[model samples]
Target: MEQKREISDEQRFCEMRATVEDCNRFACALFQQLSAQNSGNLFFSPASISTALAMTLAGARGETAQEMHNALQLTQEGAQLHAAFQRLLSETRTGGVELDVANQLWGKTGYHFLAPFLETIRDCYDGGLQLVDFQEEPAAAADQINEWVSRATHGKITELVSPMSFHELTRLILVNAIYFKGAWEDEFEPERTRDQTFYLAGDQQTSVPMMHQTGSFGYFENETLQVLELPYRKRNYVPQFVENEDGSVGLMHTEVPGGGGDFSMCILLPRERDGLNDLEKEIDSATLQTWLTMRHQEVIVSLPRFQLELEYELNTPLESLGMERAFQPSSADFYGMTDNPEGLYIDAVLHKTFVDINERGTEAAAVTGVVWAAGCAQEPEPPKVFCADHPFLFLIRDRQTGWIYFMGRFNQPEHQAD
Candidate 1:
């Protein structure tokens, strides 16, 4: 038996960095597509979605593999991407924030999946494969998956998989759930909150409770828009040196004492009352990279307290992004996953997300289930006003890694409690 070679720290860091970069680029592309399809509020976690699909990518082969690699903006090799995810996920756990990410694979009882495929997900994603009675009890299988997701997300997400989505023919289902709750480093006072008129598209307006605050924040602005960074309180973590089995010391990176692991909500506020559409049209990965280069300064800010829940059938959107063959039952190729003559193809890609931002901070949860029934910043200058009085784009991200946990457009504010 050949012993597995241990990966060096430098190699691990490179892979993790590549994965983060790829996911960020993919997030921008997907956001653009979603914005084009939906006119109202749009919210989804590109991290959660990409993680789930990357697990599925472990089983993809031929055109299916190539298309997924293209759509995902993967820069690393197939097997290396999984290892990078493992490193990235490990880093997330060390961040001193209330964040939890869970991944699991549900397989029909007696169904045969390549052992290497299951092992890869288990080792990299911590996504253990569980045998379920999808053949005899599809509903029960879905409930089990949902129950696990709910637990992983601390009840923030309950139903990730619908029984209607899978049937007796279902062979596999891959799921990823992420829950994040962070308090603002500088919180908005409830006393300062007041109802404000938020201008909507087509010269419409609605009253919503807007949180106001004046403090030193990361801020930047140009002729077109304003960028604000509201940081989250970080938990302190100490690094430990652990002796490896071979008696060699390895650096533990569970939490960086004060590195990029700090979480922050970055808001891109349009200068004009209704310039979100224009901003969306002009923004991409490179554009976003430039906008995040902000400086710190004292600024006044007014942001609407909002909550949004959205669910989407991602099959069409993903197909439109160039992974069309994976959805085609006859043409799909997942030979890497299973040797069964009737190859598995993606049946449906379900995504659900919930986000609430208020005076305190932000609490967000997202779940992505890839049913393999077939297969699937910165700132500060002067007191630049960042009044998100109209439509804007917001995302919660890891500063060091540039990993976007949740990204969306906040259009009309909904009536909700703070």
Candidate 2:
């Protein structure tokens, strides 16, 4: 008889730690760029963006590949990188969390993509190649792509690529969609939620529905801010199920914290009313890693019910991160994709994210579309009143793998910027 092995929590954490570093680095650069542009309500999935680009990178060659590797901080190559991502993605699909990651490649009809390029993505990312006629009918192609994104993301992300985005210039478009909807382990009382004033920067204030809960949660804080971990429900008992990629034993854990809660929300609230900007400056890959190890404490958590939707053009920020070659039509070299690299370059990279947090649990979805145009959270403490009335950062992370899925800031209950 042959024996099957399970990935230890420690191993998954380490791999996710490495992945977080790369994802956070890119995220920091992007946030800084958006801040410079005076953008608001920051929300997107670096993991989704990275995953789409990683699938594209499988076809990148020469300087394009090297530059991308450097920019994304992906030092591993060939077998090592693929295997690691495969295992990590598998390990993250815990039983209690509803997470679905899908990939697809849409190329201009009559375009001959190399066998190795297709094989690598299929093997590593489970990306299926789909043929679409962009050169002849761009609008129809855009509709098809958008329809897929809509279905994959459960309609949260409808328009990933606009009709005008597609034309005779397009060659290959790689897409990645991740949908996650998890309910909190400790359910919040709906009746406890009431309208509260949310403090924005300076004198701005908005009325929002705030949900209050008191429980023993994993908490941490510093002089400048505080963090609270709201864990999601896990499987309670085992049933008829097969091996899951995320190691979530179905119904194995009825509640959270005991059987296993692979998903959680970490809220970073600034100590000061208007310290969100300063707080963002202090957070990087290293700082994030440090916060994960913060000890948990019992406290009261007061959180606001909110929904956030965001879309961004990521060419500038990713280019600034040292991935300039891949975006340049002339200099870009994706030879591994096809024999000739003529007029084949990243046209644009687009990302869309939606998050809804209520009294029950959280529902979030993210979609990253690489049209070849391309591109590329916190804590608290107190007996913790955790009154997040002001601007604060938050993220949906996998505790088992340390992978961050949805990252956002709550600056307003309505359409307002952070």
How much is the lDDT of residue 254 in candidate 2? 31
Error at 206, model 1, angstroms: 0.5
How far in Å is the alpha carbon of 317 misplaced in model 2? 0.7
Q: lDDT winner among the candidates?
A: 1
CA lDDT of each prediction against the hidden true structure: 0.85, 0.78
Model 1 Cα lDDT, one tens digit per residue, 314-398? 8888988898888888889998889988789998888999888988888999999888774323443457677888999999999
- Locate the minimum summed-lDDT window of 10 residues in model 1: 373-382
Off by over 4 Å in 2: 1-17, 238-260, 341-343, 373-382, 415-418
